[model samples]
Target chain A: MKWDFTSVFANTDALLAGAAGTLRIFAICLVLGLSLGLVVGLGRYARTWWFYLPATAFVEFFRNTPVLVQILWFYFALPMLLPFEISPLMAASLGISLNSAAFSAEIYRAGIQSIDRGQWDGARALGMRWAQAMRRIVLPQAIKRMLPALTNRAIEIFKMTTLASAVAYVELLQQGKLIASLNYNPIEAYTAVAVIFLVFLWPLVQFTYVLERRLKRDE
Target chain B: MAYQWDFTPVLANAPLLAQGLLNTLKVTGTSLVFGLALGLALALLRLSSRRTFAWPAGLVIEVFRTTPPLVQLFWFFFALPLLVGIEMTAFMAAVVTFSIQSAAFFAEVFRGGIVSIERGQWDGARAIGMNHGQALRRIVLPQAVKRMIPAFMERAIELMKTTTLVATISYADLLFAANEIAQKTFRPLETFTVAALIYFVVIFAFSLVARQFERRLAVSGESTVR
Candidate 1:
């Protein structure tokens, strides 16, 4: 009937555990995603049909499909086909990693593409191979150019980690749902949950904004 | 030891799925229209000069835009009725959550477009003795809308994609339907793959149409293509 924080934050300890779980996934997924993205992204740009086309399709499939569906398919359906029954937690983590990789691939691609055309020419003109130039001259600049977008992407992916709850993972939203179901205080529970997300997300948001401005001035 | 592709089970339910597809379009289309209208209002208000006018609207846009719409939808469907002591249907909850989400995004897109205009145009419009609303309407807004078409399409595609999240709450859009069918059929790979294909088709079509619109809207008397 009225607002109640008593039940949701009935204690700070439980909320801390929930918030910690969120950060763990957020950090783990970012690492997994960025690593996978770097490899797949480089392969996509390598222009080898043996790899590029499949990598491109992989990127598109993950990027375009809803992350929630991907998580569902991985958790519910993937094990049925695999030789072994995979755990849901593994599936959730891997699915999030895979989906984020798809998006990160694009970020990588854009970062690579943003490199000056002349940089490529200059490297080719010298003794450096295509890979060498990309590594030496281009990627460094591209990396700098891309930090803002990458931070922004990371912020979004962190926000998106909430979707992991749909597969029954006990992220912030699900914790709130559980608390609400128990105490029957949906607003305070959700508000607490939303505030947790906001607290987590706000610093990243401000950092990205400041980072973007800083990078622009550097240009 | 293999997840062989199977479409027969899903295809068997095509007629049923087709109805669901129609429902998905209904939610996406209806929300797009109403949300854009509300978003335009938010954008205009955000752009308004008065301190009293812009701050509240800005705060709303910031809050809604930053948070996940699913959480917002949860608040709306479950919390709002309880808080306000009146229940809205699931469909109403979905529509309101989505419209509110779209309005935030549209405000940003529209605001960006408005800000992109040159200072000289504003001076000229105001110099002509036109009121603020008239200058904005007759001179500034038309050009801004045209500039914003590309963004509108991009936002439309994003909003449509986001509609799938509605299923996270109890709304039976395409993803929810797929979840139901998959659970019954136990055809996760099949149903969801097919679901992905259907989404790709809709988004692809929307993108094509949006691109066509962008090309059409490109001024014929344009200066050198920059």
Candidate 2:
């Protein structure tokens, strides 16, 4: 009956902490995922079957399944497989990062493939090793080309961190659920969290649009 | 560390998992149809010549697309009942949420396809004594649907993946069943792994089928073009 947000505002600190948790996981996933994706993407681009096969399989398996399922697996199954006990937070992060890595590998591969064949040949003509050519001639351009898609994926990963709540990671959505249940104002609590997410994500969407335009202009 | 690997508990829970998988498919299949139909309406509304219809439709699409599906599920499950003063079953809540959330994404897919249809095609249809509706139905949509296939498959995969979020609302979907089994047997690893494998197999199979469909469509499209 009421549209009041008094209770929602009262828990600003908790909400902010939740937002910070979400961002923390997003940043860690971005760093780890991009690096892993680069290696896998390079492997996929490699001429050697040994490098290509496993990388392709990893990407396919991870990409095919849902991230939520993967997170649950990491939280539960991974602890059984490894000797060290993994915290729920750590498990969620690893699952999310691996999922992101699979997607990023595809994006990076597309970018690298988009470059002219002459570029690779030119690098080889300069007597550079495969690694050196990829580093010196290929990756810089691919990074630029893949920036928009990668940023979009970053936003996706950021949005997906809300899934960590299912594993009890106390992220933004989980905090909202807690606040809503505690205050008994589910409408107001959810609205506040949704607004916060919108504020955070809207800019990234706009940034991608701008990047797309700039890239198109350059082309 | 010689911890014995055991699948006994997980295997014993096969019926429950199978039931969960069925529920998942039912939810996904029903929502996919509902979402696409609703999305078609939304896309048309947004593309309408009238500002009154277009702006509201655009706003609805933007808000739903921008927010997380998990939050949207929570909103439908927890908040809607509060506002309406009527309790809904978790399955009902999930179906409603998934439908609307997917409608937002599917609306974009339709809009993208519709927009890509050349302006001259519409005029050509009109030149052939077709009305606006006829032109859209007969001329524009056929070509547009082809362009929309790949995007549609991508969204379908996403929708299927997102169905897992219904578990958070206690809908007894595959993921929820896995969690329940894990809790009961104290074999979280085995239970979750089984669930994950089920998910991977289903999705991978669908992806293969979709690829083949795309290829067939492409070949037919080329022949028609020639």
* i-RMS for every candidate: 1.7, 1.0
Instruction: Write the residue-wise lDDT of candidate 1 on B44-152 in tens digits.
Output: 8888888798998998887887887778888888788888888788778878988988989888888877787778888999898988788788987777787788778
Q: Write the per-residue lDDT of candidate 2 for residues B88-174, one digit (tens) a residue.
A: 898888889888888998998888788888899999999989999999999998888877887788789889999998888888899
The prediction achieving the highest TM-score against the true structure is 2
Q: Identify the runs in model 2 with alpha carbons over 4 angstroms from their true place.
A: B218-226
Candidates, DockQ: 0.59, 0.81
lDDT, candidate 2, A28-48, per-residue tens: 998999899988988888789
Which runs in model 1 stand beyond 4 Å of their true positions?
A: B1-6, B211-226
What is the lDDT for B24 in model 2?
Answer: 92
